[model samples]
Target: MQVRDATATKSVRQGWTGRTRVALVVALVALLTASMPASGVYADQSGGDNNSGQNALNAQQRAVLYNIARDTWKFYSADVDPNTHLPLDNIGPNGKRGTYTSAANVGVYLWAVVAAHDLGLISREGARAEIAFTLIEVAKLARDHGFLHQWYDTTSGHVIRNPGDIDCATETTPTFDNCYFISNVDNGWYASGLIVVRSAMPELRGLVNTLLNPMDFGLFYDSRPQTACNVNPAVTGNQPTGQMFGGYYVGLPVEQGSNWQHYYHNGALYSDPRISAYIGMGLHQMPGDVWWRSWRTLPPKQCPTDPDFSWQGQWPVGGYWQVYKDPQSGKRFNVWEGHYTYPGSDLTFIPTFAGGMFEALMANLVVPETTWGTKSFGLADRRAAQVQVKYTTEQLKYPVWGMSPSSTPDDTGGYGGYGVEGLRFPYFGSGADASHPNLGLSQCHGCATEDVVTPHASFIALDVLPQRAYTNIQALRRLYPDLYRPDGGFYDAVNPTTGGVGHRDLVLDQSMIMAALDNALNQRKLQRHFAADPASAAAHRYLSFEKLSIADTGNGDNSGGDSTGNNNG
Candidate 1:
């Protein structure tokens, strides 16, 4: 059986054969006719009632948002794991359905269920059945150290081997030792799902407890192998010591005596940063000091060669405390780095250019980020998102503005690995910036030169930028209706240069589109539920010590202290 590589693109599938393309074209025609409105006339594209001092979604905006939720809920309802009812990773890329389960996808689905229910899109019985089935299946998962496998076969509910690749095991294939390995962020999403379930369905307390208890968050710290580097702290190695910085190893080997080598460790505090912190603070998985220590122990490095590299942590991001000055323009902007890696040497640390369009927004899905205190990454992240939207629209000229570190169609027919990218203008190479004039990756000179617009990148911004989000959604409905799939969600990405779209419909992305819109429209129900929950409340209480320090240090002023300047829209 053929399984799509789960780790390839956030929402891309393998290349389709000629035969499949013909079939897909036929299916696409039928899908468009059935799903889209015949006239394609949106009710109202005008940004609604700005004079009222409240920039709410217009009528057309609301309809598309509702459709996004309905289409995604319909897919989850129809295409989920038969036994567990969790969303399958992929569906109908080449008319082939996915058979494996994704924990992060399930987490997104759980939130979608809540969103759908709140929006009156699904019946109570339907939502209850979906939630109940998911919990039951999750409870029965073949776990190692109380964590679910990254991928699971739908039929047998058995772990799939190397799910990130084509070597993923089928239901009939025998499971291997590494198949039981844990994905920390994925499990964090699972825990997030359970917490949301418990928040919504109080009667399911017993069932939720059974499902949540086995998640041994404590194992992340205690399970490290006591090697020489660990035992002798004086050894001064790259690996972390004393505390577990972030999520545990990628996959824990099933062998009772498996060493740390078998486990894929992400000891850095910022490795996928938010999920571990979310679950850690929200679930009381570890003590406050442990969490604080993990962050404190984070390694710091700087790049002196590249002036664009700027300070160790600072970037020309729009809305953060740590902002950088564009060496040429002498302007402060809030562009956060995608990563801070020490590739060449210990002292030669280089920070990647930019972050995902929705990386920081993902944490906002559950946490009421604006209320989570100013010192945290919340405000800075939002500002960074605003910067991205502005850059994509003004600089890149995407019909709608949104871009992220996602997959893209390569000049070589196949797709490129994920990178900080977006849709490119036709004349992508005529010195768009004063610095790094010939910016690109691979043979396609325009590859890294321009930004790509995505649906969720716009949808997730609804709360922060309501009128902009509404305008973008309406534009999507009017101009790029082709992106609106029959499944009720937009495709993951689109390249403006080639006019190519992603193949797969990612549950995480779709779920975000739906849930984020719901939060923006309906009093932020999801974030309120997550923030007000006891686990998170306790986590916040314990972290008071660190948060206080954060509050003490403001993001700085325009005199080179603050990222959110008066000029920032």
Candidate 2:
């Protein structure tokens, strides 16, 4: 990871530009109109089509969404150690425990719950109970030191490892007994969680306050450790050990010069500003102090490299490319590294975090009124034109959703057969050559892809379910209108070779995409009926297309031919 000055580029701070905004709005309207059905309008039918009708509809829709969420909660929340409320790691395949208990995961879940409640998906009571349960569990681990551990073994009701340890069992004890051992990513999730929780439980203002206070030990920013520092007498006091490669010594008193001897993995050490920004803006609803300061300071101090200067391209800031220059190599790396798709369903925090940031900004009160458009395709419309652009671009560039390419094996004998076309995209499905439709199925012995159809279906389903873009819903119908099966259930997986549907199990991702889509559709309704904006109407109109032409036909199935027609519907 490299550190660079925030002043490096003006565009970084202002991510959404005027040109991009206009383009997005236009594209979204066009895409939506092309995909949705014309017969059904998203207007409120109750109370003579006035604001009151819209409100009633919004309330009704919220109730329905809440019920749906409640049904799905059972799958995530189960019998954990009552004390820890963390699911046992051994409960699932490969002994993976409590998959959804991390701060980031929980934060997203909390946001979803909050969104559902606000949209009227769950009862107030239901929302409160869920929040209470989560807070209670989090409180159980609120140690005197203030920071939470990386995770708690739900089955054992104990902290399992220090935060960010490569191996959980390697270092059992804390190196520095500080409460804020957590990183920016975890803090972002925590801050977002607090924001939603406080929104619902206003009475918990003090609790929220406690959680927000950075110095009170409630939350601490996990700093990079000086790995080379060790408790060695050779480098202690005045003894000059010739063996001191970097002349660094660990465990030296903070007052001594040795405090600066610790070697960070990367040559640079700086506190992450993004985390601070989220907490300041999202939790406190105020400007961030640390982030602002970091912004002013841009890059931080640089240190000498050691053998331990390892960069694990997994974390959001660490992995992604920014303006920051690599200290070891002056060359610039694109931020899109480590983003290659694989077959398995391994979860990463970057996409979710980025998506959450976008969602939060859209939902925030600070959003400029200029951004809000009265026309269905205007700026104020949540279902703006850019959405279509994003969807289309992502679909074309990435193709598959959810599944990773690495999960598939090579052409030679490996767990899963390799050289499959769709592997690069994040979709999981039965392995078969599209060119050779009669071939037998291929499987990855060690890494089996999750149900394939979930990703595609969920992706499409989410686009239409949300109310922000009635046009999007309409466009979806027009482009891929015939997604629903004859049995009323939508196809989850489709074997392109045989055109078979519903041959896989539905997972949490499927539910999430569906829920998000539903919420987006309901939002569109609110904007149209309650907000009474023309942009909302246009969005609906925009989506009501009769047919969508597939521009790019690369399916990664090694198929040479490209098919485009009304078959999608």
Candidate 3:
């Protein structure tokens, strides 16, 4: 399937008004100040106490987010040609058609819809209708060969490509991989879209099945072991062998190979905690829960450490190790621990995937007890039980937060080093107070660590659950609001070192941010029942977007002006 940019008939630039301009300036200034090199404040300082005087500001923020979601919905919905079931580009001034169907863009649009609904920014019915219509169109676009092309002409559901064109106007290869490499990001999006469809529309269960079932795609591997680069080179080289060994259980051999085929990294493999976190979450929504079980069953292994004490694997080594070891091995594999060649010793932080997977598992912890009827396998059962207890306890503790040390090669402060003596607590003792300017709220050592603020880190923080994840969410929301446009779009980077917002744009960043916000809001709602005091209640309400407003101004005057507008430009 061909992928093409949606045509821009009219300039969204004209939609910006003076008020938006002002808001943009103010917001940008605030963002810039927050990220200023001297400003070393961590965003979420209070662990679980949300009773700060920031309720009003929090409410305003929620309103802004809701408005952003609303604007996104209107933009996409308006572009969609109801009759053809295909989405067009932005509407031009004088009512002209701008561009054609964009598969990737539409996928993002659908996710925004899902996120809005989850955040309570849109009514359930509204979300359902939008998703239903979009899914139907998407289903129609799927070729008989099971590959979904990147773009289609909105006027006619036929696929379209860029101008340069190989065999222009004629059908080209109909493979998803052909459009993009077989990377986890692409697979994650495709998987996530399917999961959303399954969750929202039960009747469309077949679509989920279609995505899960592997076909005769040339890249398909039937049973392969996977490994990250930090593992023994012998183990890394035996990835194919491991996959072959585990072929019976894992079905297809998923390799961790990438263009950068080195012992330190894997391009094809997703090492970022954020992506893995979402993948784990999406896996929970699948039928029979094979992916979730596999994830839980996969033995963790130790490898050389990296700067952040975390490592993203390059190959499918964990699965292979598990197959060889046997299901009943009951061994705890430390996947993050890798033996690197040089300058790779600090990779001992908790498994990056742990936070994300833990978050997903927590979200679904309340799956009806009936769903667990008489399941076998002691480890699996035990893991579920542990997750249940942890999730239950966490929900009882609303606005949860975690306290961990940042990675700094110092005597008292470092990635794993608990600050001198009793300073390990949330508000790291008096020394933290004296050294860090933002009080405990902004000056935690962990925030400065590499893993805590990378795209992977942001992904993990946004996707995972537990108090720690929410704390990160709250921190980002407060500290880097500028990175997120008031219109539900987000710039790609948020500098962890300086807490500054980066100037890159990617549909993934916006989509992921929305997803994280949606998850946080949902968690807040779930934990509300356990609130014991007025403070907790306020905290829950504060994090919630339910009371937010989504009405549009006369022009595209989002209160924070077009910070995200110039992003695409």
Candidate 4:
């Protein structure tokens, strides 16, 4: 596998200079301190009676989102390789492939296809053809063991070889390499897509099962090749006991092989346990203990009470709290809250958004984190969604809302922060406004904060804050027409600083937008489909320890589980 030059890798972060960095800092302070208007501005535009604002706005947003998803289908069908039918990982303003494709893109494409078909955004026949074409392409890609490579050539369906700095590649010192490193999270996303597709069209069961079943996840967990770091440190009496926990390594390089050293985030691995645990549990790919034991040493949950910001409301972010142990001593010494790829010591006070708005909802869109056993994870989901909504209304002092870890139109990537009252982490990246002059170099599309507005985050929070989510969607369409595609869906994100929609259309972003919108409009159709599966059902059963009793179920309000039960299960 060939590795691209450092220049190619540095292209994403090419523009930010020290002057712009200072300007960005000033811009953030101004926006945060500036008074914001109320949420009623958009609600008042619903045309319907005040009481009907929510419903009317929802309907209006749904219509636009549906079209947007429909327009996005062309990228997978017409704009892709005619032979493979795999959409490019990115599309430029000129409608050309900006980069190679990847398993992550395919996974999202599959989800979008299902949503489009299920929601009647595309004809059934059209969807079946697209689905079949995509599956054939997936079958053709080179695989690490049985998993697809992180990135693929747009036309040949061959591996892209090097995907640069993204987590999909094997993280190596000096440089990251694509080298057919198998991505555990990418596989999970791909598998979830397969599950969703199978749920919709049972006819493809054999195909789905064949593609889904292979590949031993244990390979990623137990295999730790020798490096400067000790191999089997426990046996050498050099590593701590409980410090050796099992989880999937981020990826496996073709040459270096599958090992802890090749894992992403400097071999620390993703702390969002749900990526592998829940997916593996649902698919019966691994033992339930493999999933549950990861939390063997979690510290007790405590909601911080910070009056300046609503920290108390942001608990149990199920994904928060990485338990860092001294690899040699094996003593659990620290627990840091937030969705982080590295351990607790790596970040927290850097002023960076440790967890983007997207992290809060990406996995939840499918697994129903709202019902997960970790009470705080579920509570955080709702609170994060609510805070993000309010952030748009009251903090950003703009009409737009929702930020996540995404590339700004200028191609810089970072996490978004809600400029909430006292919670303003000055160095935190990714903020935007709907109105006002927050658009200067401080709000530069490509600033250090990776500041950009992503509607995908809003759509993901549909269940938690549908009204606010829908309101933002409408605002994006009505006020920021550049981000709105004629097909009714939105571009991957907007350079809110420049008020321009990005030229590139992202597959994963589209898939998320479609899935969230479909779930919002059709009574959570995608979630219900995913939950109905035995593997997902089994996983959820293990997770929902505080499920409601028969009395709670009888309350009509208790859909199925006990809503009032302790959420911190």
Candidate 1 lDDT tens digits, 123-216: 5544665566566667676766667766777766766674444434433433334454466677777777777766666545556666676676
What value of lDDT does candidate 3 attain over all alpha carbons? Answer: 0.32
Instruction: Write model 3 residue lDDT over 1-569, tens digit each, in one string.
Output: 11111221111223644345334534533443354333111122123322123221245555554454443333443455655645553343244454554544455455556666666555544455455545555556644234445445665666555412332245443322223222323333444455444444333444334443442121222222334432234543433221111111121123443321321121111122122222332233211111112222123334443111111221221122222111223323322211111011111111223222222222221111111111211112122222222322233231212212222221221123211111122332322222431111111223222222322123323222223333344565566665444432433344433555443323333444455444344543212221221112222221221110111111211223321121100
Measured against the true structure, the TM-scores of the candidates, in listed sequence, are: 0.67, 0.40, 0.42, 0.64
lDDT of each: 0.50, 0.29, 0.32, 0.49
In model 1, where do residues sit more than 4 Å from their true spots? 1-54, 58-60, 164-180, 222-236, 242-272, 290-354, 405-451, 538-569
The full ranking of all candidates by TM-score, starting with the best, is 1, 4, 3, 2
Cα lDDT tens digits for candidate 2, 8-42: 11111136543453344345334433543332222
**Candidate 4 lDDT by residue in tens digits, 1-569:** 12122221111222544345334434533443244321111011101121133333345666665566556554544345555567666655655554577766787777787776677656554455556657766876767556777677776665555533344223344234455356666776777887777667655555566577676554544333322221224323222122213323234332253343444221111233355556665555555433322322121333222111112212212233444443323444333333211111111110112335655567766666555533434444555454454444544566677777554564333223322221332222222222211211111123224346777777787666556565567777777777766543466777665686665566777678777766665666676667665557544654453221111111111223322222211
The alpha-carbon deviation from the true structure for residue 297 of candidate 4, after best TM-score superposition, in angstroms, is 12
Count of residue pairs whose backbone atoms collide, per candidate: 21, 83, 45, 16
Best by lDDT: 1
Please give the range of 10 consecutive residues that has the lowest summed lDDT in model 1.
341-350
Give the higher-lDDT candidate: 1 or 3: 1
- Candidate 2 Cα errors over 4 Å, as ranges: 1-71, 77-83, 86-100, 112-123, 142-145, 162-181, 204-276, 281-569
RMSD of each: 13.9, 19.5, 18.7, 17.1
